[model samples]
Target chain A: MLPEENVREYYMIRDIRDTPKALDAVVKSLDGISEVAASARKFRKIFFIGCGSSYYAVLFGSWPLMKNGSVLAFALPSSELILHFSDAVNSDSLVVGVSRSGRTAETLKALEICRGKGAYTVGFTIEGGSEITGIVDEPVVLDIGEEKSIIMTKSFTAFSLSTAMFSSILSERISGEKQTLIDECKAIPSLARSLLSYEDKIAATSKRLLSENIERFIFLGSGPSYPIALEGALKVKETSYVATEGLHLLEFRHGPMATIGERLTLVISCFLGENTVHLKNFVSEFAGKGADIILISNSIDLGESTLKLPPEYSGECKALLSIIPMQILAYYYAVGKGRDPDKPRNLSRYIQRF
Target chain B: MLPEENVREYYMIRDIRDTPKALDAVVKSLDGISEVAASARKFRKIFFIGCGSSYYAVLFGSWPLMKNGSVLAFALPSSELILHFSDAVNSDSLVVGVSRSGRTAETLKALEICRGKGAYTVGFTIEGGSEITGIVDEPVVLDIGEEKSIIMTKSFTAFSLSTAMFSSILSERISGEKQTLIDECKAIPSLARSLLSYEDKIAATSKRLLSENIERFIFLGSGPSYPIALEGALKVKETSYVATEGLHLLEFRHGPMATIGERLTLVISCFLGENTVHLKNFVSEFAGKGADIILISNSIDLGESTLKLPPEYSGECKALLSIIPMQILAYYYAVGKGRDPDKPRNLSRYIQRF
Candidate 1:
């Protein structure tokens, strides 16, 4: 076990440890989320906007809205929302901004622009009375999801879980579907807590596997896990200063698989889904090519390197919990590389520049 | 100039050389594209689907539908369409599949799934009577855009142009927007022909820049050129076996800029857009960090490294023509690394597997 000083030095680990509590708090605020989802139904289009890890949070958050809700929904980076998609936002549109501090300049500017176009705006942040709340019409704050570290950990998972719950509620209301989302969300905190119990195992495995001349990492996932993969890759890239790329599971085989070799390690998020067969096939193909693979999946064993979670979890819960082991891996890999996980090179906690 | 045998050895160059003619043929098929656009109006949603270079083509193609045409549009890989977006497809959707070869199994499967959901399906390929045409309800073939090389070149540009024209025509019908798209498209073949004149220069520049231990590339763009950036990165990754990542212009500064160093070269696609100022600021920031930057834009000279295109070109024409120099760069970069451009390592002409 690591010393208390060393563990405290890795402040992101503390935030990671808080994820289960964050999930529980978010689940408790389901009524508030449902209120936001009710207003979301009035909009013709829904746009999710944020920056960096928060942008990926939007990618994970927008899925349920697009798949189950009636409105056409999209997730774009805050800068992209302002620059490339201005025409798509109109009076009938809804812009949802996701940021931990609620002070990302681009996200604030994007909300301002959307509101200027007469679009209803919503803000999701950990701060109750932040800058975003003043600019947007509605604000849903998850105070327990707040982070003490520069790198996002609990907030990303918590905000994404909240948005997933929001979209699922909207789905139930719009389509009269069974309210399966609420029951599943009720189980997520415990599931996430159970997942955190594997932290030491993940850290040990990461050190054992990555100690041998690994230079690049490829993180792959499909469906909701796709954005989780992107976030995982970014966490590694930001923390350890390693070259990492995240892609859709099947999209990797199309072209990026060419770069797979001995120096590469594949981190796959193979949640329980219809595409599990294809993911296994891809893993076997990569394994034949002498690449090391670390699979984070539910119950299904893809060999000895897999970190299996509890089986039969709902889709929403699986999406939120799949990134836990990856976050642990990134943390340990940073320590292995002898870098400060608190301050990633050449990055700021908030992008203030216009 | 290269020797005859060497030139003949590069089959991809032959395809690149045929781009102008391909553009002309696609321009001639504008009536067919208009017909497809007419049918597209019946759908509430338009989804563009493909894989790899063809998937980038879909990203390029979907822009016009989302921005100019009066419908909700999205571009996704064919695999994503089949796997994650099943709920988004219904009787009120139109799925457009783009493939250079009509034999790509995923595209056909995506169309099959879309049709199974009662969505109208349209196919675009170089093969007139191929499997995609049989699978989809409507098929439009640009026969002249067919390629003999493993990598796609002309077809990507041609199909994107046809789709841009398709969306423009749809916009014209729905909103009575002026027919500037038609006049702009008429200039594309000539512009593409003129772009080929810079092939030798691009090769020379690529060789010089890459000669000094460059291993990774970052391609950045905004608006229509964003997909161009992705396609450019894929081309280099596929052909030269070099590590390349493409990202939106503003999105890069958010985090990935932390990865910038001496070994990384920034390939920027800057067309005439409102975000020009912000892009220039980003370039300045990267330049101050001592990283190499190569800019591809229309008559906008940020520095000596900038490759200038013909001035006063419309957005659609600029988007189609911007990838010319990048394609040439990838081709010669492959040749410089002594890899066969036609037979890139760990890749195939089509992805037939699930």
Candidate 2:
């Protein structure tokens, strides 16, 4: 048996490193994803639902369908869906519930409510025989192994990839044309492997942040990358108990920019979309305000602080890759702060109570 | 000429105190709101778009339509709509743009995009001659006077009330029955005045929080009240430059509960809905963790920390009233922190740049 200290030291980082394998496992399960997509294509509206990290994953996954504009796709928190939005579900709607543990009370209940409303329900999870698999009409269970740590690392990536694949396949089925997003997704597993090689640099950055006495973090992203920013902030908050907030790049300027100071670190997920110039200008303007900047992008390196991803990935694929550096940062930040990433206070693997 | 100190002293509190008058003005403009609702009822989908505080207002305003479940109603950040979700807009859609100043660049651009896509567009704003009024097909200009302070208080309430009224009228048009929400809203001006009478109590609570050296705040709400939580958090950040976050009440238990500690204040916007028990249990559990609890509710008061609201209002109307205490709290918190709420750093009356 592994010693307690050894298990604690390795659990979170091991899950972080296993993300590439998780992506590969999801790639291998494309046939299962396609089956869900086939069922999804018949619906006029799709609701992607989950809780916590899974909610962020579904948000990332729903981007392709949202951008395609052929059908209405809404990403909602499961509790919100169950409590307020269940009435929106009907026979013509498809509800996709994602839960890493497949036992999130709100998500399972949300799926039940949607089913009661006569909507097509699909469950995405790593657990094959969990409560979600039984409740959902169709369950796309990923083969990715479980994480020893409570903090989601590989499972988040795998669930996000699976949902993105589902969206891509569904988009293809609707348009009767092949999607390049599927092809772009195929490159992620290898790209994610390369991202993990920057652990030392990420650790050094974390050390530098600790040395600077950074009091809080603000993550910013645009379009498909917005969910990544949210998940990044959640990751840091859960792992290190940091005071962090995530916002749409432009939304930050609206009010949150008031919190900008030398003690604040801005982690931006940058995409080479129409708003690239605006994002660049925003970074420079905030940098001038004494805030530390860390740009995670597939294109346009702003400065030495930028964490560059493989330039080939774009759109939703780049959004998927953007979370890798954030995961690594959260890990090292927790370690630097002498906190156990494997056991965050006041949280569990899945919320059982409402 | 008035002294600088006098201007600084009155600007924010004066705006907060003017909320009742703004509600009265919006109530008097029911005819204009009805005209916009008449146009909105013809659409199958409704998109409520805004930026910052206006964004939160639109969210609160979109609740009645969202709850009715006849038409698809989405509340989105204007920047997100312009950069990503614009494709969802079509000829059968109604896009309502809300901006206090009617000159927020993103909201104006989003309205233009919706118009170009052949969708009907309506502008809701305080400024009659602003750019949005010129760009949108219809403008429901509120007669609520300009805010003396840069931080939105009266304008937020006025905009939220106008939108809520629009949603209620649209719902009544679709259902061919009178909506109780509108009748409930008619009582808001007086209810708001009564709420303002609790200013001394709110100020004492703010003083207690400051004395305790509360490092940060997390505001929580559910259903329609979620936007109020977001707006409350934003108001504090904008006014006091504090590290704050807002989450759906249940979403807080997911990952953010990890941040619960002695210096943390959980400001919950509680409602007497299906999840009332859940909200009560959540507050007690967190209180056990040594976190300060501030419950804002209409029907329930768990302890001394609970800020009671008038019990008659329910649903959307109750949600609108929930923000008054938060606005007052934000104002006093800023003043207690030795910061001028009227002169928040790195902010302007309206964001002109993208």
Candidate 3:
């Protein structure tokens, strides 16, 4: 067994490592997921509200709903929803509140407001008895997603997968692709376990990259992978004190690409789907600008600095595994920088207020 | 008269100064505005499409459409819409393509896809007879918003204001506000002129802030102001080569707040609204983190380090004026860093392809 203090120092890694098992638990919660899916289809519009990591998770989750479930879905940060777009809440709308702690203030307030407006409210929380369970009309709790560390790791993945599962179930009911999506989701644990085997390689690459004096980090992804870039960048910033940003894959070519220089490293989440050509072009452009490039994808032999994932996971499941390498990169960088992975400076386990 | 070299050197500043007149031209084009509004209301949902500064403009513009016009609106990057969310386009949807030059490749392609889906398309462009104009069902061209420099300044403000005008007109039909929103919009040019009067002061502040050895910039805003923060950050990163990011005002507290340090400056767009208290608290917290703070707002005073916009430009018009100081700050910072603001390195006036 690892020493207790050393183990505690790597709480984030432990949480991240538990994602496969956590995902299995979420898959076994079939009854709650079905009920949640049924409640979701009842509304004309759905708003996914959360704070920080959960908000990024909403961004990733909303795509599957729009693409698969054919729903009018939106991912709005809780404060933005409550302060600016509250007028958008109506009886035809559904509010899906996401929180690991289940007591995020702005999310709770937004859920309460939506409920008051006669909108259906659903809660996706890691804690079964949290306040959100009592407030939401339909509550789906995945205790396996609960994390002891302040920064979110396992919860984001589990909740994102759960959202994809719900979306797939909704789509299968309409499209008659029975058992396919569920089968794909069940494959994630084994795929994730295989991906974890590449951690030693990622750590070595991260250490070498850190030595290059890269001053800025740009993480790019498209479609469902887009929000993973956001979550990855935020984790790196919060944990490592590095200046980081995330942008939609092709959108970077427009103007922000001007920021690329010798001091920047471009981390592209390469899914090699419909966006493969464009993503490769983005990589080439940044490479021409003299910035270091790292591609995280299922494809092997994408040249140097590539972190390879298992190639077999298809559809929504690819989105689940794509973010794993980035999480590992952020963790290694934090550890190399001598920062505590479990307790990043100036951040708490949960943000309670402004 | 200023010498030719001096004028060429600071052409961006002149463009920033021209925003008021540019806004007047958009407001004066009422026939086109009314036609666009009527067409806009015909759709069940609206997608605002653009790239780079135009995308940020779309983000700023989509707010009033949802808030006042009661439309389901989204600001999708041109590439994201074309590559990922294409399925969300339907016959009942309206696609509003916003481009400064009207030749942005992804925006044009996305518009074509939406048109193919039998969706009504609207073009908000500075160039007449451009490809977007030929494609959109309803084309509103504002030549006065055109820019000679690679960086966008006047065009973003003009198009954002034009969107506000269109949204307000739609709201008038629903709420019968009797031209109040239009009146507020017409007040923008002069208000912008008043705001530009502080350019010298803003330059001084930029000098002081840059002298502090700041390595990172975090721009913050809320509501319509939020997109301004994004655009501001992008402009600074483009022009100054400084690592920069923008986020919703209070959302900064959740996690990225950990990035705050003595080497960073927090530039916030402050508007006295329902979120004023929370925004102020965010500013104070960052201050306590030892980050330099600059507030751009219509408020009389928020103590030192605040750039005061001309008071009495009430309502959504304040959102238009709030971005000017930021543009100026980016310009001065670029010049201070000895970089050319007119032609930022590794960027073009418009993106032609991936």
Candidate 4:
């Protein structure tokens, strides 16, 4: 067992260690819940809504499904589901409301609206028998230890699996490939443990990064990796209490790249959408302007890049997994800076009223 | 005429006094000609590619047409259009490559792809026969001015009107909203001019903001206003040299909102939308978190609430008129920081790469 600080401050480290057991439980539970919807005639569209980390999880999770099918899926901030875009509620829409607590106000309001509108609502959360189960047409509750913290970790992981499983099942049914994505998910914990072995390196890198004078953090990705950059930027800022941003890499040059302040830190997730030559040229331009470049890739083109992410986590998993290291980097930097990694300065968990 | 520093530092500020009648012919007369589009009807999509300021203008200018018609319009940060997502090129598409100067690498490469794919192309640039016309369709050469010290002043304004006109004409026949929108675009400049007249108040606010420890800027809106917030944030950052970000007011709370540092200058634009309540709540949350919240509303509320906007600048002018203050704020802030408002810190008018 680890100390409380070790346990809380480094949840990803802890999660990578305990993933297998958690994955086993999450898989069976997701299967059971999804079965409820399996009997339905059809789902007109897929809508994923959640708050905080779970909300961030949806950014990447829903992408595969969207790319695969014509299913119109919207991932709204849990609050917005109730506040606006509400007329969208209907029996034809399948609402997937995610909440680690199963008790966040905005998400609960959304679930109730779902019930009122007679929509087929699916709920994924840390604990069951709360409002999520009460409102959802079929609720899958896993008693992950995520319910204990204000900052989400295991819940985000759990949320990703749910997104993957749902999309994989839909994809499986559509393509008839029948490739066992669920089985692949089972290997994630073990694979993650291998990935976590590099934790010390990432932490050390974070320390070194702290020594530098990066005024802004720019995380850039393309294709489905785009939203992952958004989440990575968000998580780091929330945890590290730093000024950070994310954008599509090449977009940097046209205008916003000017802000690659002399002390700019560029984080790249090298995937295969854009031309390699163009990326190299842009990277060189920043290098010419004195920017520190950090590449996260499965390829070795960029020397000594930070995270060596698998080119393909096979499906949506890559998108979800790609964000972890950046999140950890943020946490370590926050911890190193003696700021509360959980409660960042001058911000709140939810902005309820204007 | 405005002082040399103001116009030289920022074009948004440069145009405040309005384009001088003395420079109109100089800005409009093109010395050379280029037209590669032999046929027009077979083209399926009209793709506009530019970077930064030029691209932001594209967002605002091409919007009404995109929302109203089926002509299928898309925008790329000239870099992205060239480096990535450039595979769709073919002789069947009309690619309008835009720039203040006919030389950005990405725009140029995109044009090359258009030509290679045998697609029709057009160039909307301040300088003619520079590098870009070599690859475009009908290079509609329009020179905005010699006022160019690299920062785009006359060019962007001209680009906005030109691009809007082009897209609107293509779309109006389909949506039947062309005349109304065009009339609205015409009202925008005058409305914007009136807003610019409030330079005193705007500058005062800018000077006061200079005192705050503001490290981040967040812009929020939904529906049509969502993209406007992006444009607004870009303007502020480009002109003011401020580290600004944009989010759907509601999405902020999901996770990113957690990073709203103590020094947030929150700009909330209330465009009529389904997310109005969510927008209101987001503003309140920022206020609660000790953020300096400024509500930009055309709909006047009671005292101390909003800086009442001039009446809707006629029908179609509402959205364009609403964004003028943001441009002004960006300009003034840039001046307050003693940076070149026209040629922001490290930006270029064109990006020409392989």
Candidate achieving the largest lDDT: 2
Instruction: lDDT for model 3, please.
Output: 0.79
lDDT of 1 at B307: 84
Alpha-carbon lDDT, every model: 0.80, 0.85, 0.79, 0.62
List of chain A TM-scores, every candidate: 0.94, 0.94, 0.91, 0.84
User: What tens-digit string does per-residue lDDT give for candidate 4 at B154-247?
Assistant: 4555666666656665665555553565555545545555665666666666666778746477887654455567777777766655577777
Instruction: Give the winner by lDDT: 1 or 4.
Output: 1
The candidate scoring highest on DockQ is: 2
Q: Which ten contiguous residues of candidate 3 chain A have the minimum total lDDT?
A: A1-10
iRMSD (1 decimal) for each model: 2.2, 1.8, 2.2, 4.6
Docking class of 4: acceptable
The lowest-lDDT stretch of 10 consecutive residues in candidate 1 chain B is B1-10
Q: Over the stretch B1-354, how does candidate 1's per-residue lDDT look in tens digits?
A: 356436545789889989999999988988888877786646688888888888888788777666652467788888888887877789988888998889898899989999999998889999878899899888988868458888888888888888778767766776676857677887889988988888777877777766776767889887788899998988888887676777778777667777765377889888845566666776778778776888888745667677877666546547768788889988887887878888876778888877
Q: List the residue pairs that clash in candidate 1.
A: none
lDDT of 3 by residue, A1-354 (tens): 224325234888888889888888887886678877775556667788889889888777666666643446778899988887777788988788898988898899999999999888888999989999999999889969558788889898888878777766766665555736567777777787788887778777778777986657988887777888888889889888888888888878777778776388878887755556556665776776776778887653357688755558545458657778888888888887788978877888777774
Evaluate candidate 1 and give its CAPRI docking class based on DockQ. medium
lDDT per residue for candidate 4 within A4-52, as digits (tens), equals 3463444444553454456557766765756854744466656788876
TM-score of each: 0.95, 0.95, 0.94, 0.78
